[model samples]
Target: MTSKKSDLEAAIDAAARILDSATTIGTLGHIGPDGDAIGSSWGVALSAHKAGKTAVASFGEPFVIPRHFEFLNQEVVVPAKEFPEGLDVVVSCDSASAERLGSLAGAATSAKKIVVIDHHVTNTGFGDVAVVAADASSTAELAYRVLQRLGWPIDADVATCLWTGVVSDTGRFQYSNTSPETLRVAAELLEYGVASDVVGQELYERAPFGYFGVVSAVLGRAELDADLQLVSTALFQEDLDSADITYEETDGLIDLVRLADESDVALLMKSLEPGSVMASLRSRGTIDVAAIAREFGGGGHHNASGFSFDGVPEDALAAVKAELAKQRR
Candidate 1:
C-alpha cells in the first residue's frame, strides 16, 4: 500500500493507475472556479476521458465562470445542480477543504477514492490521497505534469487550459509566483501545442463595454495608504449588474494594485447581494492576508485571501483599513 505521504512524482504514477482502473471519475474545482481552478479541473477531466475513462467536472458551488470558458466545457462539465452517482473516484483540484466542494459534497464523500491535487498554501489535504505542490504556480501546472507522466501529450485544448491556469494565477506572469520553474513549465506546455495569441486576445485584448466602465471606476476611486503600504478599491451591486461578470473576472484586480512599486498589499471588494460584499486580497513581499481574511470568516494562502460580508463597500473597506492600520502602528 502506497502511503499518502508519497512524493508528487510517485503520487502521479499511483494516481494514473487509479484513474485508468476507475469506471468513472468526477473532477471538481473550488468555489468561484477561477481560471486556474477551472483549467485544472477541465484538464484532468479531459485527459481522463481521452484515456477511455468517464470524467466530468462539477462547479462545486453556484458559481458560473465566464462564457468564454465554454470552450473548456466541451459538453462535459455537469452543472452543479445535477447530481451524478457511482463515481469510482473524485479528483479534487485546487481545493483545500470539502466545504469548497459545495453542491457536490455527497458524491465526493461517497466515492471509493478521492484524489486531491492543489498548490494552495493553506491546503489541509482532506482526501484519501493528496498530491500538492506548494512551489507550483497553479494546479494547472500540476495537471500538466500529471498528464505528461500518464503518457498524454498536451494537445492544443490541454495547452489552452494549462495556459489559462498559468496566466490567471501568475497575473499573466507578473506575480511573484511566476518562478523560473513556472516559466519552464509554461515553455513545455507551449511545445504541447498551446496557442499564446488566442489566450492573449480573450483574456487581455477584449472586454465587455461595462468592463471598461468598471475598471475606470475602480481606478478612479481606488485609494492608497502609502504609509501602511496598502491599496484598496470597491464596487457596488450596480457594478455587478452592469457587467455580466463573476468573481473570476475580478480575480487579478488585487494583483493589479500590487504592481505598484510601493504597495505591499492590494485589496479589491465588490458588492455580492443586498448588503454583502466580496473581498479579494493580494500581497507582494512578506505580509500575510490569510489571517486577515480568517478574521472575517474566510481563508486562503498567506499572500492571497478572500472573504464576504453584508455591508456597504466603503464600510467593509474601512474595517479592512483598520486591520492594516493596527499592523502599521
Candidate 2:
C-alpha cells in the first residue's frame, strides 16, 4: 500500500521526525559562518517555527555580521553571547565535522540529539542523524526540501534565506555544481518574491574601499611556484590591521587568484592569529581542493575548501605546496 521513499525523501523524513519530536531545538552553523551557513541555519530555524516547534539560529563564534548578509532578519538569529541553555536538540547545518562546530561543540554533544544536515563531500556522517546531500547545490537547498517534505510553510522571508544560500554557494549559478534541479529550486523560490537584485548588490557590489587596499597588499605578496601552476598569497594580521579591514573582507580575493590564466590552483593564506594560519583553496575544476583541505584537517566542496594550520603563514604555505605537488603528481 506504500511506495518506497526516494533517498531525498527518506533523509528529509528522518530529519523531520527528529525535528518534530523536539520541543526546543537549536540550529547552529560552523565557526566563521558564511552565506550558506547562515542561510541554512536560519532557514531551518524559521521552518521549525512554521511547524510549531521552538527553534533558535546561532553560531558559536562572535562575529560582526558580514555587511553583505545584513539583510538576514537579525531577530531570528541568536547572538553567540545570548545562546540559550537546555536545548532539547541541536541541528547543525553546512558544517561537515563535529570539531568544526567551534564553541557549540560541547553543547551539541551534550544535547539529547545532534542532527547534521549538510552538503559537503567531506562530511563523515557524524551526529545522531546525518542527512548529507553532497550532490545538492547547498545546505540551504536541502533545508528547503526538509521543510517541504514536512509540509512546513516557506514564506517569502524563508525563501530569501534559502535563495541567498543557493546563490552564494553556486556563485550565482556560475559554479559547476549548479544543476537543473538547482535552477528549478531557485526559480520556485523566486515565486515567493525573493529580491534577487538586492541580494546581488549586497553580495557583489557593496564592497568597502578598504577591501581594495587589502587585496592590493595581498596580491603584491603573491608568489608562483616552480611549475607556475600554483599561485599563492599571504595576508598577515598586520596586513588586515594596516588596511583597517576584517577577515571577512578577504572573501572574494581568492576568486581573483583562482582565475589567474597560468595557474591551476589558487591559494590564499591568512594569519588569523599568532601560530594560527587559515588557508582557502580554489581551483579551476581540474583539482579537488576538498581532498587537499582534508589533508590539513579541513573539508569543503570539491572545487573549494579551507583548513586552518597551527603554525606561521610560511609553514602553512609550504605544507600546502608540498601536498599540492604530491596531489598533482
Candidate 3:
C-alpha cells in the first residue's frame, strides 16, 4: 500500500503537475512588495522563464520596487496592467490572503490553477494548491524547496533572489523563525553563486541620505507603555516629505523602534494616506504579535506582523494600544 504524502510533498507534487503543463505563468507578491514578496515571486518567475514558459512577476498598483532590490533583474517583472490575462498558472508568494494581492487578486482568482506559497501563520489557504508552511522561516525557503522538487535550475540570479527573501524575513538569521532547515536552504542557495555580501549590503547597510532624517523624526516621537511593555511610534506623510524619503524607505523603522530594552513589543504606524494607516508590529518573543495583528484584520508570524487601519494614525495607535492592553491582561 502507498503511504500518504506529507502536506509539503503533496503540495509540491500538485504544483509541479500544474506547472509542468503550463505554457504561461504569472507570479505575484503582496502589496508594498517586501523582500520576501519580491524575492519569492521573482525566483519562480525567472525559473519559469528559464524552463521555456512565458512568465511575468508583478504586484499591485504603485508598482514600485524598493531601491535596495534594484539588483534583481527588472525584466522579469511587469507592471500590473501589463500582466497578461488567461495565465495557465498563477503563483502567489508570501501574501497571507488574497486581499493582500491588492489589485492583482483578480488575476489570481481567474488563473487556470493557483499555487500559494507562503510562511505566514495567518495565511488563509486561498489557493487551489497551497504550499503553506507556517513553521518555515520565509516563503523563499518554501519556494526553494518547490523548485528543487520540480528539478528546476537555480542559477546565480535565482539563488540571489531566494537568498534575499530568506535573509530579510529572518532578520539576518537573528529572528526566532530561523531554523536549521532555513540555514540548510540558505547554504544550498549560496552554492549557486549567490553573493551573500552584496545581498546583505543592499538589503541592510544602504539607504538614501534622507532616510536618516526620517528615522530621527520618527524616533523623536516614540512612546513607551511601561505596563504593557510596548514601545510605539508614528510616521506621517509630512514626515516623509520633510526628509524627501519615500514610503518604502520607512520599512526599516520598526527594526529601530523594537530595540528598546524595556519593551517586549514594538509598533510603528505609518500613514499610507489621509484616513489610512499601516501598523507594523514586532515582538521580542514574549508576546504573540501575530494574534494582535489578526485582531485588526491583519496577520503574520509570532514575532512580526502587520495590519492596515482605515483611520488616522492617532486612532490607529489608540486601537493598537487598547488591543495590547487587552492581551496583557
Candidate 4:
C-alpha cells in the first residue's frame, strides 16, 4: 500500500480505539448540513449507540432539516446552540475546516479528544486524529470502515444513514469520484436492507413546489461568458422571498447551472442573510474548483467546491469571474 494509505489506515485504527473507549461521543456536521454531513454524523452516532456508548448528533447552526432528509429525524439530533458538557470525544463529519464547524469548534475544544472524518481534498487536517481519506467518495464511506474496525454493529438504521451519505456524495454513483470500492461498500450497505428506491424518491424526486419557482428565477438570470467558457447565476434575497422558498430549498440548484456542457466552469451565487453570499463552484474539465474554494477560505472536492463570501451577490460573482480568468491565463 502507498505510504499515504498506510498512514490513513493507522489513523483509522487509532480513531477506532479512541471511540471504542469513550463513554460519551458527540458528532458534529458542517454548518449547513447536507446529505453527506447529516448522513455521516447520524451514521457515526448510531454506530456509537449500537456499541453501547452514549452518542449525540449536532450541527453547528440551527437549520430546518431539508424535506428530503426529514426521515433521519426519527432520532433526536441536538442543535449546536449549547454544547453538552462532558463529551468524552467529538468527531467532525464531512467538514473540511474548523471554520466550517461554526459554533461546534467551541464544543470540540472542551472535549477530551477530537477526531475528524472527512473526504474533502482540501481538508485542513484538524483534530487530534483525522481519518481524512481524500480518495474515498464520502465521509460515510470512511465512517463505515471505522465502524467495522471498532466492531460496532451495523443495524438497518445505520446502514440506511451511511447509504444515503454514499449515494449523495457520489451523485447517485454517477460522479467521477465513485470508485469500485465505493460500489462495494454500497453493495454491502444494501445487504442490510437499505431501501434504494425510497432514498432516491426522497432525495431527488420529492422537491417542494416552491423550489421550482426559485429555480426559474435563478436560472432565468443565468449568464454565459463565451470567451471564458463560464456560466454563472446570481440569486438575491428578493428572489427567495418572491419564490416563497428558504435557503435550504436552494439545494441542488447548482446542478442546473452545471448543465452547460460547453462551459468549463459553472458558478452559483446565493444571498445568505444580509451581507453574506454563498458561492457554489463546479468544473466540467480539468479545472480544480477546490483550489478556487481554498483561495476564498473554503474547500471541497475538485469538481465541486464552494466558499462563503462576505459580500453581495454581484461582488461574489465578480470575484469568482476574476479568479477564473486568472486561472485560465
Which sections of candidate 4 miss by over 4 Å? 1-3
Model 2 lowest lDDT segment of ten: 1-10
- Tens-place lDDT per residue, model 3, 161-251, is 9999999999999887899999999999999999999999998899999998998889999999898899999998988898887898778
Task: For residues 1-329, write the lDDT of model 1, one tens digit per residue.
Answer: 12343577788877777776787888888877878888998888877777777788877667576755665535457778764766899998888778777778777888999888888766777888777877788888888877877775457787788788888888789777888989998998788777788787776666556666667667777888888888888866666567766445654455566667778888888776778888988876567788778778777777888888678778888888778777666
Off by over 4 Å in 3: 1-5
lDDT of 3 at 284: 88
TM-score of 2: 0.95
Question: Which candidate comes out best when scored by TM-score?
Answer: 3
What tens-digit string does per-residue lDDT give for candidate 4 at 198-298?
98988989776878888888899999998788899987888778878778877888989999867989999988588998889999857888888888888
Worst 10 residues of 1 by lDDT: 246-255
Write down the lDDT of every candidate, Cα atoms only: 0.77, 0.84, 0.89, 0.86
Higher-ranked by TM-score: 1 or 4: 4
- After aligning candidate 3 to the native by TM-score, how far in Å is the CA of 182 from where it should be? 0.7
- After superposing candidate 2 on the true structure, give the runs of residues whose Cα lies further than 4 Å from its correct spot: 1-5, 226-228
TM-score per candidate, chains pooled? 0.88, 0.95, 0.97, 0.96
- Relative to the true structure, candidate 2 has a C-alpha RMSD (angstroms) of 2.8
lDDT of 4: 0.86
Superposed Cα deviation of residue 112, candidate 1 (Å): 1.6
Ranking by lDDT: 3, 4, 2, 1
lDDT of 2 at 217: 85
* Angstrom error at residue 254, model 2: 1.3
